[model samples]
Target: MRWMKQYGRGDNFCGYYRLLHETFRIESNIERFREEFENLYPCNNSGKIGDITESYFVWEEEGDDTSELIYSVYQNNRILYKTVDPLRLLPFLEWHLNNTTLAKLDNYLQVHAGVIAKNGKGIILPASTEGGKTTLIIGLMMRGFKYLSDEVALIDPRTHNIFSFPKNLCLKEGAFNLFDPLRIGIQSKEYYVRSSKGRVCFINPERITPNAIGCPCEVAFLIFPHYNPSNPLELKKISKSEAVLNMAKRLLNLPYFQGEWLDILVELAKKAECYNISVNNLPDTVELISHLVEER
Candidate 1:
C-alpha cells in the first residue's frame, strides 16, 4: 500500500505502488505507460500523493525475477484487474480512462463505434470489438479519411456532430499483416497479450497520415461493417429505421439522454446515409468505401 510514484493530470489520475519490496522492473515500464497514454492524457509525475477522486492505483507485487512481474489495478479500493504481463495493464488502464471520461459526458450521445471523416462529413462505423471497426478505420485513414476515434463516437445529440476522441488506435494481432504494405511500422512496436484479443498494439493515428486527427463534423454516413474472411465483400443500403435500430444497439450512453435517446438516434439516422458492408479483403473494402464517400 506504499506508493513510490504518482502520475496525475487534472482530476483523473493513477499511481503505481509497491507491495512487499520495490522493483526496478516496475520503474522501467513507467516510460512505456506514459507513452501509451500521452496523447489522451499527458501524465505528470506528481511525486507522491494521497487518495483522490476518480483515480486508479496499480499495485506491483514483489518478485525476484523481473520477467515474472505481477500487478493488480485498483479503483475505489476494489481490484479491477490482475495481470502477470505488464503490457496487458495498458489496455485496461486505457479502457478505464475512456469510461471515466465518458461517464461525465452526460450531454453527448456516446456510441460504441469507430468514427472518421472526409470532406467535412463524419462517417460512423458502429461495431463491437473484434468486429473489424479498428481495421476498417485504419484502412479508411490510409485512403485519406481523417481519424476521430477507433472506439467511441461522441455525438452531440442536438446537432448530430461527432467530436474527436482520437485515442491511439488499438490493433489486434490478426490485423497486423493487413497494414504491412502501408509500412506503418507495426513490427517495431511492443505487443500486449490480452486474454480475449490475443496480441495487441497501439499506434497513433497520425502514423497513417499527417494531421490524421479530425474535427467535429455532422454525421454524413452510418456504415455497419462485418468482417468475414470466407465471404465475398457485400454492400447493401439500409433504411433509416434499420440504421436507427442498429445504432441504438451500440449506443453507450442511452440512459444519459433519458427520454430523448430515441429522438436523437432517429434524427441522426435521418440525416446520414446508412449501409451494411460485409468485408473480406482490406483493399476491396477500402476501395468501395472510397467510392461511396466520393459519390456523396
Candidate 2:
C-alpha cells in the first residue's frame, strides 16, 4: 500500500471529498480520477473525517501499449475492489463510499428513497434500485423542488423530519434520452458503464438547483413510485398501514432500532400523507406530485 504513494505525479490530490452528512478522505493516484469525482462532490471543510477513508490506485500495466488501466480501491487499509476497467472504477468507488457512510451513521434511520422538499415540507419517494427514483427526482428538482437526496432518505426517528443527504444523483442510460430534451445538460456529461445498472452518469445536485438543498423538514408525503412503460401515470392515496408495510421493505437501517423499528415506522407513516404512484411519463408524474404537494 505504501507503493501507491510513489506512483502518481505531484499534484494528484482530491480536495472535494466531503459529503453533506459525512466527511471521508479520498486519495487517488490518477489526477483525472480525482477531478471526475471532485466535479460531482464539491468540497466542504466543516466536518471531521470519520473512520471510513478510501484510497484508489490506478495505473497502466507496464510495457502494455493497449492503454488498459488497472485499478484497486481500498477502504480503511483493506481492498474493497480490484478491476481493470476505467469506466467501472468511479461507480464502484461512489457506491462503496455511500454504503460505508450510511453504515457508520448512527443518528438517522436511513431509507432507500429519493427525497425532495418544497416550502420546507419533505416528500419521500421509496423504491428499489433502478426503479426510476433518480429520474423522478431530477424532474422534481427541475420543477423547483429542493433536492434532499437521490438515494437514501435520512429521517430522525424521534422527530420524523427528513434531513438532507444531497449526494450526486446517478442516472441510468435509459434516462439519458428522456432528460436531454429538458435541457438539463446531461448530453455533455460523461457516461460510465456499470455491471448492474448498465451505462450511468453522475449529476451533481447543484447543477440542477444551486444552494437548493432542502433543510430538515417534517415528512409531508410518502409516495412509492413504480415505473411501468405499459401503464399510464397514476397516483393513488394509500393507507398508513399499507405505507408502513411498503416502507419497511425499503428501510435500510431497521436492525439499528432493535425491536422498536415497527413503531418508529408507524409513527412516520402516520405523520405523512401516503400514496402509490405509477410512473410512465416524467413530466406528467412530476406535475401530479406538484399538484398534490400544493393542494395539501
Candidate 3:
C-alpha cells in the first residue's frame, strides 16, 4: 500500500498544504489516449487529436515504465471534461502531491494554482504555461505567503472553499538568476526544466497532501497574473462580470462545469476582491502581493 497509503495519501513538502480527494483513483499509466479510448471517445476513427469533434474519456489499471504520466482533461464546445488523462478524471489532482500519485480525498474541488495561505484567506493565480503564475507564486512563497499551486488550483464552488494543487515551482532559464538571491532552492538546469503548466517544475510533498480534508478559505482576491516588461506592479480592480469571465477561463471542471458554475462564480466575484495582477518586475510583484496579504 506504499502507493496507496503513503504517497497516495500524502502531503506536499514545498510550502503550502492541500487535501487530496479520495474519489480520484490512480490507475496504470495510459500509453496513448487513442488506443485506450478506442471504445470510449467514439471518435477513434479520427486520426488527429483535433478531429475529436465530440470528446470522451477512459481509465485502466494498466501502466508501463515507458508510459508518460499525464494529468489532463478534454471536452468539446460543450461539457468540459477533465479528460486529458485516460485513466484519470479529477481536474485538480495536483493538489495532493510533491510527486505524482493518484487517489485523493473526495471533499475538495481542486483548481489549478500555486496558492499559499495567510490568515484564512487565499488568492488564486490562474494562468497556463509561459505565464508568470508560477513565478509570482514562488516569490510569494519566499516572502512567506504559503505556496498553494504553481500549476492548478481547486475550489469548492458551493462552499467557495479554495483547494491546493501543489507542484514544484517551475521557472524558465533566466528565472533562477532572478530568485536565487531570495534563497529559493531551484536545482539549476543547463537546458529547460520539466513542469506541469510551464518549464521548470518543483514539487514539495508536505505542502499538498494530508489525511483529512482542509477547511475552505475566503478568496480575498482573484488576480489574473500577467508579466509586462514595462508595466509597473499594480493591482487593477476589475468588475465582477469581467472577473467571472476570467475565472471561467481558468477554473477546471470539478464541483460543476458549464453555466452551472455561473452562480458560484458570480457569488465568488461579489464576495472576493478581483484584480488585474500586472507585474513588470518580480520584486515589485512580491511587494504588491505582500501588501494584499497584509490586509488580512
Q: What are the lDDT scores of the predictions, listed in order?
A: 0.75, 0.79, 0.51
Q: What would the per-residue lDDT of candidate 3 be over residues 128-191, giving only the tens digit for each residue?
A: 6666776677667666666555666666756776766544444555565665543333343222
**lDDT per residue, candidate 1, 1-296, as tens digits?**
52222322223334442211211111222444555555434344542434222556665665566755567777667888987667677778766656665666668898999999999999999987879999999999989999999989988877879998877788888778878754533355556666778777777676788889898999999999998889889999999999999999997877778879899889898889999999998899999999999998
Order the numbered candidates by TM-score, best leading.
2, 1, 3
The segments of candidate 1 whose C-alpha lies over 4 angstroms from its true place after superposition are: 1-59, 63-68, 74-79, 181-189
Per-residue lDDT for 65-176 in model 2, tens only? 6555557776657777767666778898788777867776757888889999999889999999978999999999989999999999998878878998877889888788
Of candidates 3 and 2, the better by TM-score: 2
Which candidate number maximizes TM-score? 2
Better model by lDDT: candidate 2 vs candidate 3: 2
* Steric clashes per prediction: 0, 0, 45
TM-scores, each model vs. reference: 0.80, 0.87, 0.58
